[model samples]
Target: MNYLTVLGLSAATLTTISFLPQMVKTWQTKSAKDVSYIMLITFILGVSLWLLYGILRQDIAIVLANAITLVFNLTILWLKIKYGKTRPRKYL
Candidate 1:
């Protein structure tokens, strides 16, 4: 509850939750045609590192946001692996 912590939480919430839309869309559509596999892989690695950093530092905001982000990223990565190479129209 200090002002800075509140700001931290807000920032964390926004940045973290921003990944949700992409995850849900990919999950529902099962299409990641436009999403870069390289980007997803790199982003996942970065987030995982941040999650580890958060755990080491005992930072709640970092931990919570990165944990949620990890889930979404993993889902998107899975979808990409499962569907990225196939014909999009076939799925539709």
Candidate 2:
């Protein structure tokens, strides 16, 4: 592997694995109230695009990284929607 490729893979590995902690935490707690729906939605969209780009360009690093990120982010998004509850009006 070339130096540039190694560097890119390293970065991709780190960022992709970094989501593990959050995924495990959310899985265990089954709560994602602190997570932002807009952020997750946009992130999923961006990752999906990146995955497509990687496929078109035949970039393994980008494809692998975005694939993992997409799965993690999707799980979190699903959990957030599943656990989130409707809020009632509160008059103070």
Number of the top lDDT candidate: 2
For candidate 1, the per-residue lDDT at 9 reads 82
Over 1-92, each residue of candidate 1 has an lDDT whose tens digit, in order, gives 78877887899999988988888888777788888988988998999999999999998888998998898888888898988777556543
Candidate 1's C-alpha runs over 4 A off are 89-92
- Model 2 Cα lDDT, one tens digit per residue, 1-92: 89878998999999999888988887677677788999999999999999999999999999999999999999989878877864333458
The residue ranges of model 2 lying beyond 4 angstroms of the native Cα positions read 86-92
lDDT of each: 0.87, 0.88
Task: Give the Å shift of residue 31 in candidate 2.
Answer: 0.9
TM-score on alpha carbons, each prediction: 0.87, 0.87
Clashes of 2: 0
lDDT of 1: 0.87
